[model samples]
Every structure is written in structure tokens, then in C-alpha cells.
Target: MLADGGSRGLLRKTFGELGLLSLSAFLFAFSFPSFISVDGLWPLVFIALIPIVPVIHRCSWAAAPFYGAFYGFLSYAVFNYWLTTFHPLAIFIVPVIYAVYFLILFPALKAVDLFFPRYAYWIQAVVWVGYEYLRTQGFLGYPYGNLGYALYKVLPLIQISELTGVWGVSFLIALIGFFLGHALLFTFEYDASFFVSLKVWFSRRKAALAVCSVLLVGTLIFGFVVMRGSYDDQRPWKVALIQHNADTWKGGLPTYRRNLRTMIALSDRALAADEPEAVIWSETAFVPGVDWHSRYRTDSERYALVEELRNYLADKSVPFILGNDDGQKADPGLPPVLSDGRLNRVDYNAVLLYENGKLRQTYRKTHLVPFTEHFPYKKLFPGFYQLLVDHNYHFWEKGTEYTVFETDNGVHFSTPICFEDVFGYLSRRFVRNGADVIVNLTNDSWSGSVAAQMQHMGMAVFRAVELRRSVIRSSNSGMTCTINPDGRLTGMLEPFAEDYYIGSVPIYAERNTLYYHWGDWFPLVMLSLGLVLLLVGGVRKIVLRKS
Candidate 1:
């Protein structure tokens, strides 16, 4: 399999280009919150894609996909460096998926640049938004690194999220990136001094100005007006969010016992400080499967622990919400168990609501973390599934329904377990289905990275504005906080710390939020527009060639 001299030369050139482009991605990665600075170097975002533009424009159609994948992997790998902490395999797996995505995107960017040089950047922005929409769909959808997430603190700019979800903000930001990127390309095209090329770029700014100005000004105007309106805490319900600071990866009776005690201590202190209407605990705050152990009594020790939890729940005056493993027997009609003569049982990562000393309702997590949490389709991806299984990955069966919980005082809400809050559609659905607030129960203590925690919380901010629903994030060990409808995060507790937050979570007056009714129409529109432009470009190219 040794390559000849010519092939080796090509390989060397390719690796050299890849190494160079990764430096650009690294520069852009600092635009998001990280160890570089918690409040990211936001100004860099406007020019982050400057280096990417020239490559796509110069590369041939045959070479575009390869470069696209190269860009995807490097950009994501640097931005999501925390994936390595999650699992050694995750850093590669997550970015490689993006690589496959950019294979389509990169070629299209090049094709559009070749055919329609004048409006290439504008169309490219639309295409980028479309790609983000595609990436955040299906089982593999992780809406973490979208351009909109970087501007979480920029209230005026992100106000567009109400009408267009995060897609609109992404489109605006991406357009800016492309506009600035094209300016750098202009310098090379002119073969002139940098200052002279800069002046020329500014003079020919009609397209970018026309699009960016109207959106930018209108966004700020809307934001200021909206911000001025008082968000009345008229329908307020106090909730105590408990962060026990537990390492979720560690399992067994000892760890479980310690985490539970910490949660109780925090909850008691919160109750003492303020009489919260209810208490919220992070995901898997209790490790033992409550329903399964109480019913079947699989292990005597775990069963005893479940009994203790039941007694604690019974004594609580107000409703208590916590995350646990909800286990049930698998159907005989399903595929044979991976177990060798073991109990044919399936477990769900679920949030349970207890009132009057009884389990009232349960919401099983719908969106599972791809390979780590749930990996089905064994026949199609046998090797990958086996690889995951070999790594000791325990998969959970996907839950089909969205469950809404109601407290004794008639406070209606839904708990979107863990990363579920990061997805816009889930929060919209919860609000649509009569959930007054969105409460997220998450356990991210295992990552051991504050940057990772901040990244997760940053994405959740958009869900609040998109649906106009108050969002409460209660996590084990960090990022426990509440977000208002206007996207202002309040009471954001320290990451990876044992703490509790009691907040007056608002229940907005039931009114039709535009995004809730429209769903993901904005992104769909962008995707359609991108397809149409590419189709037009193909037709134009063929017509010109034939003539």
C-alpha cells in the first residue's frame, strides 16, 4: 500500500493545507466561551470565516468536499474540545459527523462561487443556516455550536430568535462572516496594496449593507422595545433547584448514597431559606431505578436504597421533582436481549414528579445522546454498534411521548431531561402542549469542564426566547439557573459545585408565541432557498456550456 513519489507529494500538500486551515479554525474557536475567556472574544466572530472563503473559492469541485470536511473537523474539534473529556471517542465521532455534513456544504459553496461570483457570500450565508438546521435534526442532532449560541449575551442582536428561532440570528452572523471574508478575497483578486483593496471593498458594499443593515437595526429596535416591557412576576411559582455535585460516571451504592444525601441537605437548606412551592433535582440525581426496584426488587441493597428515597418523598410537604431510571420489562415480540439469561428489562432516563407521597407523572427523555445513550439500528451500523457495546456503553430505549407535569397547586410545566432543552422544537412542543415553564434536569458533572457546562447552558438560552417560556436548568454540580423569556439568564450558579438556587420562575400569560405556532419554518425556508439557488446555478452552468 506504499504510495509512489507523485502520490506522496499530493498527500504532503493536502496535509499542509489542512494544518494551515486548522489554525484559522482555532482563531475562530475563541469566539465562543472557553478557557481562553469565559465571555468569549465575540468580536473575532465577524472575521472568523475570512480564511475559509479563499479556499472554497479557489478549490475545484472535485477538491471542495475534502476541504469542506477538513474545515468541519478542525472547526468543531477546536470549538468542542470538551468532547475529549466526555469520552476519547466522542471528540472524533462528533466532528467526523460534521465532516460528512460539510462534504455536501463545501461543494455547494464552491459551485455557487464559480457560477454566481457577485452574490456568492449572501447565498453562502443561507446555505450555512440550512446546514445548521440539517445538523440539528434526527437522532444525531446536537444544537451546540451554532453561531447564534456565541451571541447569548447580545440581547439586541438575538431578539430575532422570537420570530425566526436561532436560524435568523445564525443567518445574520454567518452573512457578516462571509461579507468580511470576501473582503480578504478581494485583496488577492485585485493584487493591490491592503489599504487600497480595503477601500475598494467598502465602496462595493451594496449587497451586504442592504441585507445586514435592515435586519440589524430592526433587531435592535425590537429588542429595546421588548426589553422595556416589564416581565411581571404576577404568576410566579418558587422552585428550589438542587445541585448535589455528583460525578455521574461513577456508579454503585456508595456514590449513589452520598449524592442523595447531598441533594437532601441542599434541598433542606433551600426549604429553610425560602418556602419553595416545589423542589427540582438534577437528572439521575438518584441512580437506583425507582419503579423497577420497588416492583421487582432485583438487588437487595439498591431496593433498600429505593425504600429510603420513597420514605423521604412521602415526608415532603410540597411536590418534589427528580430524575431516575424508569425500568420496565421488554416485550417478548422485540429482538432477543443482549443479556445471557438475564432479565429482559429496558430502562429509560426519566423525570418523576412526586406529590402526596406518590409518583404522579413521569417524562422519559426523548432525545438521547446518540451512541453514548441510545444506539439502535444494529443491522445497518453493526460495526459501530458493536464498537459502542465493546466500550461498555449501555443503551436506553427511546421514549416516544412528550409528558407534561402538573403540581398540586396547578402549576403546569414540563421537564426536558438533560440536553433536551438545547433543542428548540422540544421546548416549543412543551409550550405548545400547555407547559407554562421548561425545567431541565441534567447531570453534566462527569465532563469536569466548566467550559462544557457553559456551552450547554448557552444553547438553552435560545429555547427560552424561541418559545417565550421561562427555562429552569437544574444540573448536578454546575450551571443551575433560570432564564427569562427575553433571554436574560439569572441566578446562574457556579459550574461543578454543590449548590442550590431558589428562584421565582415566571409563568407567562398564555398567549400565542409566534415560534411555537410556526415551528421550525425559518430554517426550512432557508434550506429550500439554498436548494433552489444551487439548482439555478446548475442550470445556468449547463446553458452557458452548451451555448
Candidate 2:
């Protein structure tokens, strides 16, 4: 009877702890993009992980990984719910892969607690940032939900990204979560006078508090100073962003023609009103590939379609940057054929610039999306590659160079197609290559989710702030807008709306951001520090065991 009672008690306690962990996961999800419309609720991110911290601290090392994985799976499943819109399988696969990150993180935190007991909170925070840095690396490095993105609307707080990238902001947020969690743990668990417990916790963690305060204050001061600095030499380039709310998937050729006509009519109206320097179109704005402009020049029907577009551009007398599939004849030296057994040609998702009916520049999309766009490690697994091919899944070959285009007026810009703009380093490379502005051409009609579009825009805003460059994003279905150097949205078009916006984007010639010069160095340093600590901890444990 006594043994049964003890087992039941232990089971009840375990369930209670799991409940707290679940609450933390829920709060963490709610603090991110989709769940909360109000950006002011971002402060909830600081305390969201507090509940899980206690669970992690109290659980045995063997159990910590499971708890962390469960927490991560639940949190990510909720935060990235839009992934299901792409495929139902994503709900299972993505969370399972993402949970491995937390599984590793929790054990590292336990090691920190065991090795550096006095500064466990600080070490835990470092480990958190280190894990986040790791998440942004390797074959499947996705830089989503980095906590800093929650503060996108808080312009002043995010200017620090210029110096430290998103990792620094994530480090600050993790530090606050650690501090709050530690304080809460002391308040609840300490079996002393409440005030005494408070004083003891404060004394023990004063160094962490001091460091966090300095970083927070310094970041804000730096932000304000940068914001106050005048852009007296800044030149405004008026741009017309066209969003033709087209259902590219279900839409046949007739629908495509109608959408194209609508976009052309809208562009004409916008040009008549403002006469912008250049007009931009979303990804794959038309059906015909750039190759058809020359490849099918002999075919009257195909040639006429290409001629119609060229004539329109010539009539407008304005330069245009638009998306198209540009193709090149495959090298005969290459061995393996495509799934269709045709290796005659290779196609690229490219952005082409046209001035007075002549193609001036073509920038192919690099950093293709994994699996769906370009399968990683396919050479090693030929069977899996064949399987994908059997399913009729066609992937675009990755582009090699960072291509930047210059307008006749001497304005320089780079077009990063689709979610390529989400990568800070890729955008930084363009800025380094003398791109004054980023023109992103994307087609977001597939997901058909407003939250997904807004979430993507939220991340893209950071790219503008990180490099102190303007970003003009034109999407097929939504989020067509101009973002200034300060991350402010201007002339934003409504989601799923057939609309066009004309706005002036400030061109900053100076590209001296620390992030641009030294990409992601802060996170790399943190990751290195974490590795050193783990090595030291492992050495100490081995020495003690031998002794």
C-alpha cells in the first residue's frame, strides 16, 4: 500500500511539471508571429521559457532531453503552423527535426549547471544562443523564429542587428528569459524567508543582471544614435511595385493572360500618375521563359508573345525588373540526365532587367529552398532522387554568382527571389557587391495564407535594417511594399488584393555596417565559447573520474 501511494505521488508530481512545461511552450508560440497580431505583446517572449527552465533544472539529466524535445515539438508545431499549408507531412517532419536542437540544448544546459553552478544561468543563456547559431548553419539551417523577429515593429531595439546580426538580439532575449526563470525558481523553491531568498538570488545573479543591463542599454543607445544620424546624401528612387493577385497554380493560360493584362493596365495607371523610374513585377509574372524570347523566336505564336512584352516595355520607356525562368543548353560533357531523360537544357529561376526592350541583366536565384526546390545530398542517394523524379517533382539547378543590376540612372540593386531575402548573409553579400537596394520578386500564392505572408515580410524587414539598405518586395498575391533603411513599411499592398503601389525608396550609398563587414561573427564567437566550456567540463569530469 505504501509503495503504491509513493508511485502515485511521483506520477502526480511529474504530470504537474509537464503541465508547467506545456504552458511555457504555449506562451513561447503565442509570443511569435502568427498567434499574436499585437506587436506590443513581444515582452511575453522574455518570460515564456521561464516555466520550462524549472522543469529542465529539476529533471534528471537523462529526462531533460525528452522534456526539451516535447517542449520544442509543441512550441514549433504551434509557431510554424503555416507549414501544414504546404504539406500535411510537414507538421510531423519539421517539428521532429527541429526538436533535435532542443534535445541537444537541454543536455548542454544540464552540463553547464553541473560544471559552472555559480554562473549556470549565464552559461545556459550562452548555450541557447550557441544552439541558435548552430540552427543557422549546415545543410538544413533555417533561421526562423529567432526571437529577435518578434521585435520587428520595435525599430529602435533591432538597429543593433547592424553590429551583431539577429544572434545578438536573440542572446539578449535568452539572457532575460534565464534571469527571470532563475528569479522565479528562487521565489518558489527556496525554503527560507521570502525576502531572504530574494536577496540571496539577487546577490548570486547580480553579475548576470549587470551584464544584461549594459547590453540592453548600450544597444538602445547605439540604435538611437544611428537613427539620429542624418541621411543628407540619401537619394529617393521612385519605384512602382505591382501585385497581380493571381492563383498561379490553378490558373490556366487564360487566367494567366487575364492576370498579365490586369498587371499591365495597373502599371500603366501607376506610371501615368507618378512616372516612377522603374517598375517591378512579381516572380514568374508571365508564363513564357526568357529562353522563349530567343529559342522560340521562329515560332510565330511564341515570338508574338515575347514581342508583345518587349513592345510594352519600349512603349513605357521605363526600365523593368521581372522574374522569369532563364535557360541554358546543358553541357554535353555532363553525364546524368534529368528525370524526364532530357538533359538538353537547364533552367534557372531568374530575375531579368529590361531597358528600352533590350535585356540588360539577368540575376539567377541562388540558395534554392531545400527538398522542394533542390534536393540536398542527392548524389549519394540515387534511389531517393529517382523516387522524387518518379513523383514528377522537378528541381531548379542552383545558381553560382551574386548578380547585381544597375539601372540607366546609375541606381544599383540585387533581386533575391522568393525566401532568399530571409538570409542575412546572402543579402549582405549583395550589399558588399555594391547593391544599394534589394528588390525581392516572390510568388506567395501557393500557401494562400496571410499569416505566412506577414511572417515572411517581418523577416525581410530585418534585412533592410541589417545592411542599412532599402528593400522593395513585390509578391504575386500579397506583401508588395517598400521598406526603408529603418525597417519602416511604405505603400504596403493588402494580401490577396490586385493592387499596385508607387513609393520612393531611399538609396544609401554608404554600406559600412559591421554585420556587412563581418557576417554572423557574434554568433560564431558565442558558439566557440560554448564549445570551449563543454570541452573544459568534459575534461574536468574525466579527471575527477580517474582520480
Best by lDDT: 1
Candidate 1, superposed: residue stretches over 4 Å from native: 1-20, 332-341
Candidate 1 has a TM-score of: 0.94
Q: TM-scores across all candidates? A: 0.94, 0.92
Clash pairs (backbone) in predicted model 1: 477-496
What lDDT tens digits, residue by residue, belong to model 1 across residues 1-547? 3568889978776776676567668767888887797777777776777677888876667888988888888888888888787788999998898889888888888887887798888899998899999999887998887888888888877877888998888888888888777888899799789989988887898766776788778888988887776578458888999988887548678989888888888988999999999999989899898998887787899899899889988988899999998888787554324346676688899999999889999999989988999877789999989999998786887888888899989899999998888889888888888898899999888777787788888888888888877889999977899988878987878877788989886788466567888988998999999999999999999999999
After the best TM-score superposition of candidate 1, give how far the Cα of residue 197 lies from its true spot, in angstroms.
1.8
Q: How many backbone clashes does candidate 1 have?
A: 1
The all-Cα superposition gives candidate 2 an RMSD in Å to the true structure of: 2.9
User: What does the lDDT read for residue 319 in candidate 2?
Assistant: 90
Superposed model 2: Cα runs more than 4 Å off? 38-40, 193-196, 297-304, 332-343, 379-394, 545-547
True lDDT of residue 347, candidate 1: 89
TM-score of candidate 2 on Cα atoms, chains taken together: 0.92
